[model samples]
Target: MTDTIIIGAGPYGLSLAAHLKAAGIDHQIIGEPMGAWRHYMPPGMMLRSEAFASSLQAPRSGFTVEDYCRLKGLAYSALGMALPLETFVDYGLWFQANLVGETQQADVLSLRRVDDEFQLLLTDGRALTARKVVIALGLKGFAQTPPPLQGLPARYASHSERYGNLEWASGKDIAIVGGGQSALGLSALLHELGARAHVLMREDLVVWHERPQGGRRLLARLKTPDAGLGRGWRSLFLSECPGLFHRLDPARRRLIMDHSYGASGAWWLHDRVVDKVRISHRTVVNSAAIENERVVLDVLSDGRQERVSADHVIAATGFRTDMRQHAFLSRELAEALSTQGGMPELNSHYETRVSGLYVIGPASAHSFGPVMRFVYGTKHASPTVARHLSGSLKADARQRAPARRPRAAAGASR
Candidate 1:
């Protein structure tokens, strides 16, 4: 049996695997490297995060996005530059190749606890056992569709997370539901791809992040320091002090999360979206129906009902983190998890209530803080988890080892 198995090859999984490998821990990582980014995101889409915030964590330095940029001679900046999706994916792959290599490209069909170990059934018909398992499955199987847009065929509707290319909607009328980054970004891409794209949102106004400033004066930097989340005292606290965030009462923690970050387009997206795409604010889709091979949305806006017809509707609604949604998890295991708002409760080291089971990445955001939702959060998660697992695994090994007999005193006994 392996000491541990990580079930994803995304940023978080790969980073943690790198740390575990450095710590001389016996583990296996499985999944497609940069799977979601390579398959789901649109071709020309840019990352919402700035350059410095997008690095995958490792045990050592010289593996950052900045390091990759320097090695490749690519233009680099901490902010004020939009990172292309291709560049970020390439960087992740590079990290995987150089640090976390030979990941098993297989899917876990089922996961259940057996006696004292966890058994994993793989798509390749291989069964594996491990003392510990880490679920790093990023955002997969958690797409949330608004109730109004449910039960529509793929031809009529699709979630934003399913798109790797927007060319199929060229010259078609598309109504995107939501005002967040996904909606605005998709609208921009769809419009630029020759599709008539419009945004529908429940908010009266669309919020846009102000452009980030670089090379500020020392006093200005001290006043508002740049952080992994963003620039501000609150952002600094959330970005750096996830442990503290986790200690607050659950209700207060949720309150902080609710008010901390709302839907807003990236600074670069504002110029591409505003005035370029039609946005219907204070709008909610009441129902959707397909007529004559076209999707029609019955929407409420400003207390008035209206019918908006589009060739297809795209739901930009984000993901929901329900552990039960992971079908691979057995019913018993799912029910055993103590959760808050469908998120698994995690200890300080990111372990679940079930011993030897851990979660990282966006799935841990509820317990760790909003930082856990971003790639930047790997900085804290990777080493923290590696240290805990390494120490615990070693202790377990010592306990399992056979005890030595008392040595004969000065060769008196043979």
Candidate 2:
């Protein structure tokens, strides 16, 4: 048995493994590296955050995008600058192969508490027991399609997450929803691929920063730890000092969600994509009804109701943290877990109410602040979680006998 079993080998899982290795902790990390990133992201997309800011954290800090770029003779731009999503995936793979080697491609089907440890049953019918488990599933299985569009036929409607190729929709008129970066990026891709695309959003204007005049000078300042928007008093109070924000209680959390979760496109995508697409802002889809293989949507815009018809409707409306959406989570386990404003509640150290089970990544946003969902939070989360696991395993080691190593040939695949 291993000291810990980490699920979902994305940035969070890989970084946790690196930290555990540095601390000399005996652990096993399962799942494909950057699995969600590889499967969900569009083909030819770019990251909203800068290259330097996006990296897998480890005890040795020098091994980052900055170092990787310099070694490969690539330019190292400041934070908030965009990098192609494919390039970022390549970088993540390189980091995983070099830093963490125990990664296996396995799908965990169910997790149950057994004695003081947890038993993870794999899809292949293998069982592994670990002292603790950390769940770091990324945006997959959490993409939220709006309720209003749920009943539409599959051919006439789909969510952005379901899109893999634009060839199927070539020479067709498509209506894209939402005002976030993904919506704009998809619009740009479809337009470039010979599709007639138009974006509809409820917001009046697209709020995005224009390019900085002097290269990286202004962008770097905004992303710094002590300057600009990210370092302002309000940001600090929400992230660094969460107590102030948490004190408001349940009623306030819902109000904050409505206001804070509003979507806006990224700065890099403004002139490149937003300028090209025809946007009908301040327009809300009133009702969607099918009409002869087309989706007829009744929309309200500028104090007038309008009818629109489209061959396909794609909802880029972002995801929610609803734990019920995870079908694998057993009903018993769901009931046992605590919740905060429809999201799983977690402790400061990323531990949930259930002993020996922990959650990280986007799911842990309520506990560790909003940074938990972004790449930057991995810096603090990985080390802290590893330290906690190390201490807990050491304590349990005194009470149990040394784990017996499974016979290698006996457990080999048939």
Candidate 3:
């Protein structure tokens, strides 16, 4: 049995593994290296975050996005320059090579807490036990499509993560639903692909993110500090200190989390979206169904109801921390979890109510705050979890060891 098992090899998993290995912890990471980045995210897309914030945390400081770019002899920018999706994937692979090495590419069929250790069933028809398990599964199986489009078949509508290339929708009428970055990005991409596309947003006006500038004054920087979530005192606090959020009352925590991170298009996407793709604001999809070999959307917008017929519908509704949807956890284990709004209730050490079972990445956002959803959170989270685990393991070892006897009768006269 391994001392610890990491279920996913994304940024959080790799980061925690790096720390654990350096601390001499017995652990194994299983999953595709950079799997989500390569599979979920489409090509030609650039990260919304700045270069410095998109890196996986290492024990040392040399392995950053900027560092990767420099080593590759590519153009480097620490500020909010466009880091292509491919570049980030390659960097993640490189990080895996240098830090954690190749991960075991096996699917975890189910994870069950059997007494003290976890029984992990693997796709390769093997079962393994581990003292602890870390579910570092990033944004996989969490793409949510709205109710209206949920029932439609795959040929008609799909989530943004379902497609890697939009060329399949060429010569087709496509409708993208959402006002967020994904929606906007896909709209632009579809327009470039020579597809007829329209973006439907519930908001009247889309809030385009302002381009991040360099050489800011000290006062300005102090007021709205740079962070993964963007420039703001609240953002700065959440990014720098995630634990404080976990200490807040549940209601307050939920409120803050829900309100934070309003989504919009990248500043660079302004030109591509404007005058290129049609955007229908104040639009809400009431219902969707397959009609006449296509999907028909009954939408309400601007106090009027209208029918939108399209060859395909792309949903960019985003994800939630709903634990009930996690199919990997056994029924008994899933029922045992103490959750807050489907998010696992976690302690400061990222441990759930069940001892030795931990969760990081987006799953821990409710505990650690909005920053937990971003790759940047790994810097703080991985080290914190590693230190706690390492200390706990050593303490356990000490407890199990036979105590040494004191020198017999050193002071007694024989």
Candidate 4:
């Protein structure tokens, strides 16, 4: 049995592994590194966040974009402070190779609480037991495809998560929903790939924040517990004291969740994509029906209803937190697990109500505050969860000893 088993070797899982290894904890990290990001992200896309801000949590050996560019002899541009998605993936792989070498490239099929441990069943029919388990599965399984558009056929309708290659629909007329970053990014990508795209957003205009001036000084302030773009008491409340945020009444939490989703995209994205795409603001797609190889969308723009035809519709509607969405979780286990609002409830230490089980990343939002859903939250969660696991392992060791024959009994038997 291992001391701890981490599921999903993405940023959070890998960062936790680095921290656990640095603390001399005996653990195994499993699942594909950057699994969701690799599989779900659009090809040739760049990350919205800065490169320096994204790194594994290790004392000195963590992988960073700067290190990656230098090592690979690739020209590193400081433009926009963001790294290409491909570069970020390469850097992640490098980090996994050097810092988290014990990770297994396998999918976890199911998990069960067995006594004081977790019995993980892998797809290859291998069973592993662990004193503790951390679920770092990212936002892949939880992509929130809006329910209203469910009736449209798959050929004429798709979610932004299904966009692995925009090139597949070259020269096609596409309608994209949502005004958020993903919608804008998809619009830009589709346009670049020679597709005629129309972006329909309920908002009055495409909104985004300007990049802060200065260099590392500005970045340092942003990374602080209560400063930069993540300022305001709400941001601080979520980042610094997540437990308190978790304790807020359900109505208040819902209000907070709605308020938190208001933040928009990067300014550069507007310059690159929004300026080029045909943007229809204050517009909502009322309903969709198929009409001979085309999607007839009943759209309401500025209180006027009209029909628009497109070969495909892409809904950039964001994700929702519902434990029922996770297919790997058994129906019995899903029902047994406690929930807050619609999200899975977690303990102060990031563990679920199910003993010996823990969750992190987007799945931990209801417990660890709204920041748990963002990529940056990994910085705060990885170290804390690692410390908790380490302490638990040490305490468990003291409370339980290996089974051994008594000295008298051994001698007599021999």
Per-candidate TM-scores read 0.97, 0.87, 0.95, 0.88
Task: Sort all candidates by TM-score, best to worst.
Answer: 1, 3, 4, 2
Candidate 2 lDDT, 1-414, residue by residue in tens: 878899889999999988888889888888988877787677778876556557778778666877777777876675555777777787788888778876868888887776787888887788898888898886667677767688888888888875566777778888988888778888888888888888888888877754433244555646643311243455544544443444556567556555653566667777767567878889888889889888988888777999878899999887778766665566666666647544777665677888778888877766555656677667768888988888878787766777789777976887
Clashing residue pairs in candidate 2 (N, C-alpha, C atoms within 3 angstroms): none
Off by over 4 Å in 3: 402-414
Predict model 4's lDDT versus the native.
0.76
Better of 3 and 4 by TM-score: 3
Model 4 TM-score, all chains together: 0.88
In model 1, the clashing pairs are none
Q: Give candidate 1 misplaced runs (Cα > 4 Å).
A: 407-414
Put down candidate 3 lDDT per residue, 206-291, tens digits, no spaces: 89888898789999998888888788888888898888888898888889988988668888899899989999999999999888
RMSD of each: 1.4, 7.5, 2.2, 3.8
Q: Whole-model Cα lDDT per candidate?
A: 0.91, 0.75, 0.86, 0.76
**Best by the TM-score measure:** 1
Model 3, TM vs. native:
0.95
Candidate 2, residue 319: Cα displacement in angstroms equals 1.0
Candidate 2 wrongly placed segments (more than 4 Å):
212-233, 236-258, 401-414
Q: Give the CA lDDT, 0 to 100, for residue 372 in model 2.
A: 63
- What is residue 359's positional error in candidate 3, in angstroms? 0.6
